[model samples]
Target: MIQSTDEGLMRLALREAAKGLGRTSPNPAVGAVLAKNGIILATGYHQKAGQPHAEIEVLKALSDYPSAKGSSLYVTLEPCSTYGRTPPCTLAIRDAGISRVIVGSIDPNPKHQGKGLAELRRDGIQVTTGVLDKECTRLNAGFNKWIISGRPWVIAKAAQSLDGRLTRPIGESSRLSNSHSIRMVHRLRATVDAILIGAETVRKDDPELTVRYGPTDHQPLRVVVTKTGMLPIDARVFVGEQDTIIYKDRSWSDVLDDLGRRSVTRLLVEGGGQILGQLFDNYLIDELWFFLTPRLVGGDKPTIGGVGVQELAGAPRLVDVRYLRLKDDLLIKGDLQWPKNPSRAF
Candidate 1:
């Protein structure tokens, strides 16, 4: 059973873990807390990619104090059992002498799936799971999706004026959404692994694509999808070779292979409409997060995606729908429910 104090500490850990977003690329944001004798001892959150994990940092923070031999540990995700950029977190937890472990969610990756829990139990540590399970899963949805699926989770976002136009007529500069909504967009950027846009968006907006607010520790990878690879060399997103990925009409297998090699787990697609249509047409998208404002712009500019289709007679279907009201805006989130046979076209 989890005590109220335990739940409170876990909430603090989750909030701390959220701060590591945008910086902890290729690593799941994790939070850990140690409590002994009804008193909290140490807390830590994963900060960046290729660095020590949350468990390791917490253990280190408590090094000079009393040992954790009889303490309880609360973690956002199951401790890792496989070694990657850092050592397996299970081994570190054992070394800390923690008597009991409470995990929020299990790691879905096959390599270290149940091994971490099994190892802790074998070493005589009492382990409990599913504390705030849904919340933990929601926080790490991107990492979970990547571990289960081959591709990244897709979040599609757009902002438009009261007239529903992303930009003014004749390509004039205009503010699509207010400052509050724009701030929320930046917050979304802080949580995802990557932000993607089409070549046309790059040519027109030249977005910096970096986390500009809150903690500046991490930034998402900026990606552009172009069939002919016509993106400008000096675009703000393309600061160097490492910061950008240009998706061309290459072999599908090759593209997947490259993405695997790069360890790209989650991908957020911010669109100029045509790009969204292309991804949907190719059946490459896994999930969709849509933010629809209450205002409507009846113009010739664009509506989400510009690929003018006469009808949705043969389009993919949404499997689920969720709605959230943010101030005056309506966020309609939907998940694509592909047919039983994935290869079959709608």
Candidate 2:
């Protein structure tokens, strides 16, 4: 185990690494920090694909530091030693005169994996692994999932009333989540590669569905699912110039396969209940974000419309549930553990 002080630096590196969540598809987000004499000299993270890796950026930031030799480097993922879109990060670190390296998680990409660490050691640099490793793994869940399973990690988000009603009435458009919770949902959208919704949601709410909470140059692609391809051109979803996709009666497998081929690492499903059910029916959802509002919409209201299971045992179960209070709203988050796919079980 690394010292607690070094572990703390690794945690900072991991946090910086997640800033590239939506931008770095087909590339694992990595963060690197250079420290000397118990002080962080500079920190950098992989911003997007087809660009320099974290170690190179950090080295460039620290190049002007006087007497920077023997500075230690802390990186969230193992540095790549082989060339691809950019030069090897290991070469940059060595040239920057970093003497020791600490890695939070080992890279599993086919090009590097264990070879990056081996290359660093061959160059007579000190190396330590597994510093804040669990958190680092969670940070790279989508990238790792896509690397192995060929499907983006799906997260389904729903906000319902205290009585589980998705809305007060069937035809009316009303917001169930508070302002705080709504922004939380938008932030989630900003972090994923795409946001999916059913045609009914667009027809009813006409939401802009753009990221308005934080500084973001890129927007998540908007995807609409419909039984037919017919949609109003004047709808609010089409008002913006962002890329949008419509799928007519496409199987969940087909949609997922297409996204995987595009290297989409993460997807967010903002549901109108039936869409969530459709994903569940196809066994595609991987995580669940259920928020319960403070108010109760109890009198003959539609509660989770069109969601059903033939038998009790068929319902998807939430494991590792964590509860928190967002203002007055109750937030429940967990892993959506589905039955294993028989064909892929082995």
Candidate 3:
């Protein structure tokens, strides 16, 4: 029973929810709206973990508005039926006396799978789903991957010079790509669950790894994988309210378990080659997003690690490839398909 205007507003809410992307790690980006008599009462987007979710935020913004009892509630994801850091959103919807519920997507987590819909139906609310399936799923892909696969979707990112070098030379400060591409990197950061880097990249680049586009309301979890856990405690990435996790000499299964326990479902690996190599060697990479600049730096620096002769001899193969043109750069994306218990390719 979605009207044209209702669908348009739902799109707006989805975009609003996307704004919460880089910030609401360990929590899904969600948006909600309260509507009655074809009039919008309130709207909200989930801002961060431990804060009021989208539904709760919108209800609070309504603030005892007398006519909310018969309003319809529209949300980007199924209202969560379980209590975690906050109260169950299903309970909030029921308490509001909403006459109808429309959800963009369902929660893929087994614990809450279909439970939210069941709860709403049991409470005599009319519930409809799949209003904007594709956008909603895209927004919560990280959450779905973590819930269904026990590991976050891996996103490999890199910035190289015109000649495909990460840097001019070791320990040298040189620009690798243009400002537009760098801004796109920030946009990518604004949408992922977390940003990961190797200890060497942290020590050498000293990146802050915070989202620099739009608002600064929330930051993604900053993660570092180190063999010796040698990252400096005083690094700038540690100064923010963003949660940080360090994986040290742990098996891939152990790392996935830890991230699952912490509710991280999507992870971005931004590296200095060596870290990328290790992930590839372990057959842990799921997706690759490569930005190929038009210029070239014909230096001795490596492009991407784990692509050498020994590594490629038995490495995982690319199952899918897509091309995107961004100004002068070409974005090459691939899906990695690793064999069962594949040997260490590197």
Measured by lDDT, the strongest candidate is 2
Each model's lDDT comes to 0.73, 0.81, 0.78
Candidate 2 achieves a global lDDT of 0.81
Name the candidate, 2 or 3, with the larger lDDT value: 2
lDDT of 3 by residue, 53-167 (tens): 9998888889576667999888988889898999898898888789898889878777887899999999999998888977797777677777677678778887765566676
TM-score ranking, high to low: 2, 1, 3
Q: Which parts of model 2 are misplaced by more than 4 Å? A: 63-67, 298-320, 339-346
Worst 10 residues of 3 by lDDT: 337-346
Give lDDT tens digits, candidate 1, residues 1-346: 6766767777877887777755675677888888887688888989888899998888888856457878988898889888799998888888878899888877777887778999999989999888887777767766776666555566667776555455545566655555666677788787776787878888898888887886545577777777887878888887744477777766534554466456666667788777766566556666666565656767666535535334566455765677766677666666676544455232
Count of steric clashes across candidates, in order: 4, 0, 5
Give lDDT: candidate 2, residue 79.
87
lDDT of each residue in 141-189, candidate 2, tens digit only:
8888888888889998888888876755666666888888887887778
Top candidate (TM-score) = 2
